[model samples]
Target: MRTDPTQPRLRPARRGRFAPSPTGDLHPGSLLAAFGSWLLARHDGAEWWVRVEDLDPPREQPGAIERQLRTLEAFGLVSDGPILRQSSRDTAYREALDRLLGSGAAFECWCSRSDLAATGGLHHACVSGPQAGRAPAVRLRIPCGESVAFDDAIQGRVAQDVGTEVGDVVLRRADGFWAYQLAVVVDDAAQAITDVVRGADLLDSTPRQILLQRALGLPTPSYAHLPLIVDAQGRKLSKSTDAVPIDDANPLPALRFAWRALGQDPAALESCTDLAGTLAAAREAFSPACIPSESVALHNTGVAIAS
Candidate 1:
């Protein structure tokens, strides 16, 4: 399905998403990821979607979802479709889980974190079958030596043996909350996402997601993992660190910094007077070739690694 050399690469029907979990204000690292996905989708003439991953009621702040979207909107990175929230999509996730469960590809797991730790999480001993008395967690039964490999848009060849390296992935926690891996996999398929442009931190998780997609007979979207923004201490910048929020009222400095951090020549945008101009110039200049394979440190962002 290669594009013709004489034609544009974008399709009007092509879709991308900047799915975020609402936990706090937008910071530099989070903004960088959002801007990256937004810029790429717009550059290719694709429809970009915003999905709020608000599945975890306990961790999510009361008003953080609206605030996060407002921040992206303030920075001119708006979604093309009606915003989708995971909280409203439980039926979809459950259906997908049911498919796997009925296929015998998923099973009830009763192993606690401590139980898994004691048995070496990657081994067969860690996978406890359904127990009558205990609350059960749903986990995918990965075939042994399930070696999956894919070429990343930016990071290049990535390969993972999920069965050995990651063990069985939890689809639903004992608390009954849909697991991040399963929810994200189901949501991406539901949205018809053509590409996934996000931080490098989630690169390792892609194989697990791909396994789920295959088990459920869903299409796997192309992936591009941007370098992560870290701090002076080399720790990934995140909400847990209380990352400083970016100022949406004055976004130029942060945009410029993000542009450079993504390996683009920011000097070309010197003539652009405003945020729109900067964005316009970026649409022309955005190249996966320019983005680096490794993660780089950015000062702050009030969120954790998102994909």
Candidate 2:
């Protein structure tokens, strides 16, 4: 199996994307990610796109995508291009899996969650199995000693040993849906995204995506992981934590707050009439270095001023 070298490489053009799964409403944490990605694309003079990761049908809320889009619109984070739906990209994902298999970069494993759990999470037993051709989830073969390292604009240098840390990650799940890591790498490469800006919660996942890019012979994109928004309990804000959804009825205040949370000085731009202008101002003055590395609690003011 040979790796395809014809896949596009990252060039000077500014292309970025914000992909969100339709599992729930856009909470404050979600807004921070959207704003961060939007600002990164704007600052780099790049085109921004959105991809609906509705691949996992069971977990998707019937109207969650529409609600999420409205929330983003309310916050003035409009993306270019018709939104790409991962559910419609089954053939593309299958082709990518086939390519991985042909290149000997991926293999089929029949290990179930319970089976893998018995051996302490890592799929060591599956890797040593003698069975072949079982209807199994496909896993990428992480080459030994191969290191995935990338320079993150916010987090600085990041390096991961794929074989030991990530093990053989799933490409196609036994449940029939494609894994997030595989779909993301494929979509970003297809869209020619050169930069990825999102929340710090995904910091660990970056290495896995980098591994996929290497195996698929695709160009890796630049990354900037912003500080994560957390609740009073120190857990990352999400629907489960009852984090307030973006207040669509009055979005300006929340947008202002999100900018400040990302370390942009929003005080001077208080007079900005609309969300778009506020975001524009933020991009003009956006500095990744300004964002504090630590997570701060949001106050009644919606701002994440240092604690």
Give the TM-score of each candidate: 0.90, 0.88
Q: RMSD in angstroms, all models?
A: 4.6, 5.6
TM-score of candidate 2 versus the correct structure, residues matched by position: 0.88
lDDT assessment of candidate 2: 0.79
Task: State candidate 1's TM-score.
Answer: 0.90
Q: Candidate 2 on 221-247: residue-level lDDT in tens?
A: 889888877766777887345476677
Q: What is candidate 1's lDDT per residue for 234-302, written digit by digit as tens?
A: 877783373777786777777877777788886766688797898888888887678877677654322
How does residue 169 of candidate 2 score in lDDT? Answer: 84
Question: Where in model 2 is the C-alpha error above 4 Å?
Answer: 1-11, 125-134, 300-307
lDDT of 1: 0.83
lDDT of 2 at 211: 81
**Candidate 2 worst ten-residue window by lDDT:** 298-307
Number of the top-ranking candidate, with TM-score as the measure = 1
